[model samples]
Target: MNEDVSDGWAASAVAWIVEQGEDGDYGRRFVLDAPMRARIEGRGFRNALDVGCGEGRFCRIMQRAGIRTTGLDPTEALLARARELDPTGNYRLGRAETMELSAEFDLVVSYLSLIDVPDLGAAIARMVAALRPGGTLLIANLTSFSTAGQPDGWTRDGEGIPRFSIDHYMEERAIWVSWRGIRIQNWHRPLGTYMTLLLDHGLQLRLFVEPEPAGGDPERNAVHRRVPYFHIMEWQKPA
Candidate 1:
């Protein structure tokens, strides 16, 4: 949500593209995309607005699946990469907090982008406004358990067995994420905060998925074996 966060993403732009291709990365391949596609595939949505769509990877996926999709992001570098990858893609310069559109899209997607948004309320409001009546707004985000937990990681026992910790579930906080040379900031909000944001706008929850690893290094994804790595929620605007 901090406009300053744009600098982090801009710096990590090329690294993200290299690390997170259409069907790569542990999280993207094992959890996010399939569920996002499943939620979108059978629906008769003619168009979608992918808010905070970094590099337009997911937007390209939806477009290839025959859904007209527009990728919106605040970072200039990432948007440039998106355009380069998909010359015909509708990649636009926009921030979640101030996004406006004339067309009411049938679907609006927030994929791992909400964590970066500083003005979450305004963003959600715009997401609701962008949806057509009875349309869908889907999100795949870091679960509260993950975000509210420590950023440097958990305390390990003498045996080096790591255990995750959550110190503040109710308070909003910003955490610095540095991994694999990709540095960024992610906002952590309570579970109720996100649910209430959408419900307050009259969007009804239809599906919730706490994804476990589809297939990956068992040891690396072991956290998912007992704890959820991310959540995919499907909410619908009343018809």
Candidate 2:
């Protein structure tokens, strides 16, 4: 695990979330989307591992749906809140890449948290390892890269290099970068990149869902409609 990078990023991101209150912007919109419910149904997974689980929101959702869930995160504060959310549920403090648990889960999930990691490949590899043979790996996140031959519609100001802003790269990838007082870098991976990564890890792609923008600030919804902001992917580790 790249402790410094992962820990620093998790701490800062978790702090931002905590400051927003438990039901802040991210907690309300991103976490409560319908796709999460659909993934559990579509994949037929009863046991789950939530990588980068924050505040245990998703875990609780899974629990309600009858999927036994274990939430894992790098930030202690986040795990603390997760415990508060479900005292009987399991919560662990650890980096996704180094998560070592004896149990093999039927579903391994990473919410929007993967974007903050330093090495996404390593993180995915670990999740794959934790999955039971023939288990499902479901991921939902923002696409920061381009797709097919379409051009990216966003751009950024060089002055705010690592800061979150809209930026378009040559590969038609669109990235939304945002920044607070510290730890200033936010990037989403495109659909193509995500597929390639799954193939590289020998995971079979079963379903890919590009969710249409639902409800939020209308202005924000209009903006997300153009970019691949929300997606859910289900892959299987061949039985």
Candidate 3:
């Protein structure tokens, strides 16, 4: 893992905690949570490892759904908040690039965390290894199109409507972004890069989703109706 990325998260962890607390923002509360929970609630997963589990929000949710969850993150401040949220819960200080747990879990989730991780192949290899045979890996992330086409980079045409400006999207690039107080580095990797990394390990896609806003600020979520902002994918390890 890159030390810069780790340092960046250390700085941003507090603001991230605050954002997670305040209605989970548009993506978390309105779009990602429901569909993820739907797939998780009824499934019988004995144990789950939430990799890059900043603040342990998803771990707590999974615990409520009866899955024994372990939250793993590198940021100390975030882990501290995660511990505060669930005093008795398992929140470990580790990154996905190098994680070893007591045992493999039936479910492993990386929710919007991979963007910060520099080495997708290394990080995900560790993640896949942490899963038991036939286990599932669920990833919720910004699609390459969204990551490559940042609002700041968009150019307006004669009509003043923004048009996406993309260059070298296939090449991995570290892009920095901040909103409110959350400042961090997000990597932009093409779709094929992610697919090849997972498929090379023999994981098979079980479910894929691009969720829409449940119902809230129409203006804030209006773009998602036209283009998918986030994608959720479930991959199963060979049985």
Candidate 4:
């Protein structure tokens, strides 16, 4: 993770935890959970590693599905909270770019965490290295469009419709995002950057989806449908 990003998260950890609660915020509850859980549960993975596991939410989910999961995060406070919440879980203090484990997991996940990483290539290389042969690397990330619209997210037009504007779509940089008392730095990179890096590492794409919100919040779902912000990708390491 970038120094600023790390610092930002460390400072915002408490607010983030409060905002996330036990079930997670609107996006995870409404948009990401079902699809991500379905993909993992159907795969029969023996063991998994969750990069940036934050409070061990997804780790608990995988554990419930009968997959041994290790949750890793660089933030000490969050890891402490995770351990406190799930005392039986394997939670580690670590950064994605420098994780030393290798060939140990059948499934590795980055659930909305890649945006916080500073060295995307190095982090991805470490993730691929950690996977055993035929293992899966699953990712849930903010769409490039969403990141590119940062700093100035949404605006109201003459007709009162929401308009999302994108500028510097191709530039890779970090911007601070604040919401609900949480402020953190997130990296912005073009979509192709992620695709090309994963492909270059010899991982084959298995699934790519832009899941629509299925939760009961009609107003929130409508906004998400108009401009989907998250995408999930599943990739496989060669056997």
Candidate that scores best on lDDT: 4
Error (Å) of candidate 2 at residue 25 is 2.6
Q: Which one wins by TM-score: 1 or 2?
A: 1
Writing each residue's lDDT as its tens digit, candidate 3 over 50-112 gives 998988888988998999998998888888998887899988988888887644799999999
RMSD of each: 1.8, 5.5, 1.9, 1.5
Q: Give the alpha carbon lDDT tens digit for every residue of 93-136 in model 4.
A: 99999999979999999999999988999999999999999999
**Least lDDT summed over 10 consecutive residues: which range in candidate 4?**
1-10
lDDT of 2 at 219: 66
TM match of model 2 to true structure? 0.76
TM-score of each: 0.94, 0.76, 0.93, 0.97
The true-versus-predicted C-alpha distance at residue 149 of model 1, in Å, is: 1.1
Instruction: Give the best candidate by TM-score.
Output: 4
Ranking by lDDT: 4, 3, 1, 2
The per-model lDDT (C-alpha) reads 0.85, 0.68, 0.85, 0.93
Error of model 4, residue 175, in angstroms? 0.9
Please report how far candidate 3 places residue 127 from its true position, in Å: 0.8
| Model 3 stretches with alpha carbons more than 4 Å out | 1-7, 151-155
lDDT for residue 75 in candidate 2, whole number 0-100: 72
